[model samples]
Target: MTGPIWLQWFYVLFWIALISLMAIGGYFMFRKFLKALPKADGKSILDWQEYYIKETLHLWTDEHKALLNDLVSPVPELFRDVAKQTIAGKIGELVVKEEAKQLSQDHIIRGYILATPKRDHKFLIKKLKERNIDISPYQELLK
Candidate 1:
């Protein structure tokens, strides 16, 4: 049973070939994602976060009744990378927020805010602050 037979050798080669193909396929997929990621608006996704915020604001006015005017909204003119980071859920919220913070250190408003129900916005902001992000800059700007 231990002897090297043609069939056994062929089986071993087939498994090896399959694994090699899978690895190559995975790499190709990752490469395609990277290429498409920065293609939006011809800028990095990070740069487009602000655009999302604007869209969110417009959606809010057009889609729902205004309830809490005091509630701070995210900056309508800043990148929403933090919100996007949380979105992927591929990485932890803390990691993504930290990266977003690092990018927006000087701006003072760092992170993303979506137009969720008024009830959840507070908890969401609290969660962001726990991650060491400040939505104040955007909030203040929104008002």
Candidate 2:
């Protein structure tokens, strides 16, 4: 009759297995849910378009978003931040140009190029300078 203890042990083992499976499944589902949810903070390139709203889109909103989306992926997000007064007007000229500048990876800042990329870094600096961002000292590095 004490052999019935084996059955109890079996039941306990089965319960432990089931509980573990449920917990693992729940955790994975939660992770997927978080991925699918919109990241309105714009912390990543994938979060930008999701956060962009009709009201926030200004002056060729679709176009700006289309171009802005290019900085990331088919689903763009970003960590960029700006003065939150009126994002509409500021988004296009101010943000767009600055975003383009940032995308080049040249790190153009105040008439100087600090850190440069490996390949095409010169081209990026040249492009920024052509846009009048002023990347001069780094050009000397080329020499």
Best by TM-score: 2
- Per-residue C-alpha lDDT of model 1 across residues 1-143, encoded as one tens digit per residue: 67669888999999999999999999978865674477645865444544444433322331121112222334232434433333322222323444442222222222223333345556556655765755665575333
Model 2 residue 109 CA deviation in Å? 27
**Per-candidate TM vs. native?**
0.26, 0.30
Tens digits of per-residue lDDT for model 2, 1-143: 55698899999999999999999999978865775565566353224423433323443435444333332221112322321212222342333545442222232121122222235355545555555755564556544
Candidate 2 clashes between residue pairs 3 or more apart in a chain or in different chains = 44-77, 44-78, 45-76, 45-77, 45-78, 46-77, 47-77, 48-77
* Top model number, lDDT: 1
The TM-score, computed over Cα atoms with residue i paired to residue i, of candidate 2 is: 0.30
> Which sections of candidate 2 miss by over 4 Å?
1-3, 41-143
